[model samples]
Target: MIKIDDYAYTSGLKDVHPVEKVSFALIFLLFTIISKNIWVACFTFTVMSIGVLFKAKIPFIAYLKLLFVPFVFLMTSLVAILFSIAPIYQEDLEVLWMAEIGLWQIYISSYSIQQSYELATTILASVSCLYFLVLSTPLNQFIWVFKKVKLPAVFVELMGITYRFIFVLLEKMNEIYIAQSSRLGYQNYRSWFSSVAQLIVSLFVKSMSSAKELQIAIDSRGGDEHLYDVDLSMGYNRGHFVIIFFSFITLFMIYIMTKS
Candidate 1:
């Protein structure tokens, strides 16, 4: 998670207008789902992967590790879908195959495999689109774009606070883990579990303490309701917008032809 934020801050495309990136990511994401075409899914995944690896300069190994997580889950779900149990199998049944387990039968229909493949690719493509957005645009810039559109101050404030606090929580968790490791807290399974439970309790107490300190500090400074106000200079780039617009248009046209 920290590495994701780090890449967003140092991305080569960070200088580009956040709105343009947002528009591109969202538009393509919608098309990827709506088209419901395997080709479109492949296209969307390829485009976003290229942008993340080449344009955003994320390391290839790191990107693979990120993708490996979802890929494993996808495969697991697909495997689960490829089998089912019934009380018995009819000799005239039209299933691809079947196996007996005592008085029960386990089998998979061709439709289940087809549906799983379609759903898995669709999920992968949509996730890739989101990955592109977050990797290229940090939370600050994302909130800045929302602020530009005059979103409610309270909503923007919550988003900013939530994002910042995520990093704070991660930092605190890391510190506790390192300290525990140094003390042989995870030398055995029993000790590891105890250490993890303590870590959670300790983190909660620390977080509450920090929040109280922050509240006192803010109260001292007369409190801030509009604290999310940040100045960012972002201009709409017609060239980037045009490229994205036409790219999706062409992609849709191909979908139409291939779909028919």
Candidate 2:
């Protein structure tokens, strides 16, 4: 299983009702997205990080590694916003630092810095909120929640199947890579590229075969109609819901206070 999935299944909060986790994550995500003040974004980030690390019992290093993946993308986007390029400098531009390249100049300004900070904090806070939910709630629980919300069966089925396929493909790819490595397929750069190409082709063929086998297995058990009918009901805990409601109120109050 993927690290995230394993963590979710083993999470301290795994026994909590899935609806509570989902509502908490999505509500905080909306708050973080709509928040205008940096403080609000920072607050959301802190709260979600605490939930993931302490409440959910996820390892700090593992969470940081997961967080770093998005941080890299956030930095890439923020770089463009943090710096400006122009053919000629303008006196009113408030350039904090500048470098000349040919006839063009690239510079940073206080305004750009502030904008980048806000964007980065907002994005990070939103991601943290999602991490809290995914780290604490398993995929089957999410599927169970979806069914409870009366989502279309086909959509739910596809989501479950697609999630399973991701792991299947990963398993197949890992096996192929190990086999190739054992055969010295990556002994050199040229062979590395060739091995990767072969691995891709092999993975695709194996995945197709796995899908066919899965279909046969499904058919043998009747069909795909009631495939996901397993009981995942864990009765709701009103205390968790109450805590989330109060948390939202607190965050809303913080947002208002910060706005003024």
Candidate 3:
């Protein structure tokens, strides 16, 4: 099982209706994006963090590791936006700091840096909304909710197949790694590169074979026509409804404040 699914199934809120989780996450996500305020985004992240850790019971270390994935990209992108180059001092400007490299100059603008911070916070907050939802609800349940809304059968089927095959691909890659390592495939830097390249080629071939096998298995199980007919019983959680109600109210207030 995928690690994320593992957590989802074990989540404290896993038994709640997925629609509740979906709507709650989406509401905050849209609010965070539209508000365009760093404080609002930070507040959104905090609330989701509370839901994930206290409500969902996901480990803090795991959450940190997940945030690290996006933080790396955010920092790399921020470098470009926060810093600018100029030829000497063309005009009087309010810069946070400036550095002279011989005839050229590089400077960080206070206003631009402030904008970057808010943008990063907004993006990370929006991402966490989905992350919190995914962390609490299994993919099958999520897909079931989409089916409830009448999402196209072809697209839903593709999503299920793509998700199912990710583990298959990873398994194939692992087997190839073990085989190569046992035969001294990564004894040095030169061999390590060769081993990785070979692994990629082998994994590609195996993925094709895996897809074919999966299709045959699916056909044997009465095909994709009945895929969405699986039992996905959902029960309403009154507490979830109340939480979402207040969350929307709060977001509305924040939106008005930001506009003002």
| Number of the predicted model whose lDDT against the real structure is largest | 2
Instruction: State the weakest 10-residue window (summed lDDT) of model 3.
Output: 224-233
TM-score of each: 0.91, 0.93, 0.92
The parts of candidate 1 lying over 4 Å away from their true place are: 90-94, 221-224
* Candidate 1 per-residue lDDT over residues 1-260, each given as its tens digit: 99999999999889898888988898878988888777888888899999999998988998888888988988888888878777784565558888889989988888777778778878898988998998899887898889988999889977887787788989999999999999999999999999999999998998888778867877888886576767777777889989898978978887988794
Instruction: List runs of model 2 lying over 4 Å from the truth.
Output: 89-91, 218-224
List RMSD in Å for every model shown. 2.0, 1.8, 2.0
The list of candidate 3 runs beyond 4 A from truth reads: 217-226, 258-260
Q: What 10-residue stretch in candidate 2 is worst by lDDT? A: 224-233
All candidates' lDDT scores?
A: 0.86, 0.89, 0.86
Q: Write the per-residue lDDT of candidate 3 for residues 59-156, one digit (tens) a residue.
A: 99998888889889999999898988888857776778999998878999987788899889998998789779989998888888888899888888
- TM-score for predicted model 2 compared with the true structure: 0.93
